[model samples]
Target chain A: MTLLECKNISKKYGEKEILKNINLSLPSDKIIGLLGKNGAGKSTLIKLINDLLTPTEGEITVKGKPIGVESKRSIAYLPERTYLDKRMTVQAVLTYFSDFYDNFDRQKAEKLLAALDLDPKERLLKMSKGMQEKVQLVLVMSRKADMYILDEPLGGVDPATRDYILNTILSNFAQGASVLISTHLISDVERILDEVIFIDKGQVVLQESADELRTREGGSVDEIFRRMFRC
Target chain B: MDFVFDNNIPIYIQLVEQLKTYIVSGALAAGERLPSVRELAMMTKVNPNTVQKALGELENLGLIYTERTNGKFVSCDSEKIYALRLEYAKNISAEYLAGMKKLGFSAEQAVIYLEDLGGEDFDTSGM
Candidate 1:
């Protein structure tokens, strides 16, 4: 079933168009990798889906309802930047998530924390950047939401941590929930993705199943992406 | 056992295939202890979550079993692994042959090429 849909979505900052006439639907039970260059407006699209920013000219719906507090409750978001309070300990951060999200699975979150070797008492500020990213992912995945929007999830992490983060995402989360992951590092996430949506210059250039795309191009997703974005 | 991932295939699937290879080859002996998720993640430089997914998939397929406090171990049932390996090889070989045919190679020519590439003795024993 289609869990999320965006219709004729458009956004602008001053005169610069960030997203233009965007329309997309996310089906349940798949991992979608959203690809674009640094300024291809990938983040803008994510913000629109999470309702962090309002679209200038369109509407987004979650489960047939427009985005609002009710929709937000069923949607888990991990922004590209650090959104967690640095002063809070790992335990405190988890508690905050539990309080806000009714579907938050505290046990699952704690299990992930233990697997990552992150102490509950460790302050967010004291943890390394990679550790912090893992913490953020743990919280996001712990929520049994209908939709998960992860922006640049592997950004700035070492290769080892990247794999761990990817694994965590794969292992956690209930079936039938859709995950939308936005990233520029296509090669890393390409293997886990069921479908891929390529955005370029504020427009969705292509959206297709990863396997079909590879079959059509006779090459890997990264290769196809390079060709599509070739200068 | 170490896993070599292909970007063309999904990581989780690649992982499942790799574990199956080890089990089939006996390199990862039945009842052998598998690496911890953290250890595998650190080795592969992948997220622990991805590793967990791979392991979870294996468990679901009954190719591996978890011992809770001790960690996950390779399943003792050898036939299942062998069967999985056979199925995997059939699918992969079929895909490869189909691709070769699409490239204009006849069946006989494809077989000849496979033999010439020393794939006849292609050992599935080492995983």
Candidate 2:
């Protein structure tokens, strides 16, 4: 089933075009890697999907309905920057999510916390950056949402923690839920992705199945990316 | 337990194939506990999610089964490994042949090349 659709979507920031006539249809059972260089509108595209920002032109829909607060409820978003208040403890974060998202699975959140060896009472402000990232992921993935839009999820974690974060993302979620992961670090998360969408200069250059692209291109996604974006 | 992951190939696919080899070779014995996802991640220095994906693929194929309290374990059915190996081999052979054909090797030339490489004498008994 098509979980999300963006049709001829365009966005502008102070007369500078960030997204140009974007069109995408996301299936419910795939993990999509959104690839782009810096300032390629990857973040802007995500915001449009989540309805955090409206398109200057065109339209988007979630399950055939227009983008709105109701659509946001079915989507779990992890932005590039830290969104949690640093003073809140792990337990408090869980409580906050539970209050906001009805589908928040407390048991899953607790399980993830236990696995990560994170104490619920520990304040976010006191934890290291890597630990805080984990906490954010835990809260995000604990939701039983139809779509997950994670932007730059692995931007700054240590190598050791990055693996755990990835594993938690894979193992924690239910089947058939679509995940849209946006990042320039393609090699790290390439294994779990079923499809990829390459964006450049506010335009989508390509979108294809991961396996098909690899077979046809005769190299890794990173290599293909390098060739396409080479100066 | 050792593998060289090609950037072109997905990490989970490499892990799945490598684990299959281990199973077929009996290196990872039936009923043996596989490494925790984190442990494998730390060992490979890859993302834990990559390791989890590999493990998840194995579980889906019935080559590995998870025991909730004890973690993931190798399947007791040894034949399953060989079945998986056969399937993997067929896929590799098809891709290899297609690649060779694309490189201008005729069917006859490819077979002759395989024969000259002593491919016929190689053991196919395992599968």
Per-model TM-score on C-alpha atoms: 0.71, 0.73
Per residue, candidate 1 scores C-alpha lDDT tens digits across A1-231 of: 989999999998899898999999989877899999899999999998888999999999999999999889989999999777899999899899889889999998999899888778999999899999999999999999988899999999999999788878776767678889999999988877778999999999899988678777867789899998987
Docking class of 1: incorrect
Quote model 2's iRMS.
4.7
lDDT of each: 0.85, 0.84
Instruction: Give one digit per residue, the lDDT tens place, for model 2 in B1-127.
Output: 6766777866567777888788867899988999897577656544455677789988888989999999999999877777766887888788878987897776666666687684666443432
Chain B TM-score of candidate number 2: 0.66
- Weakest lDDT window of 10 consecutive positions for candidate 2 chain B: B118-127
For model 2, residues A32-128, the per-residue Cα lDDT tens digits are 8999999899999998898878899999999999999889889999988876888999889889999999989999889888988877889999999
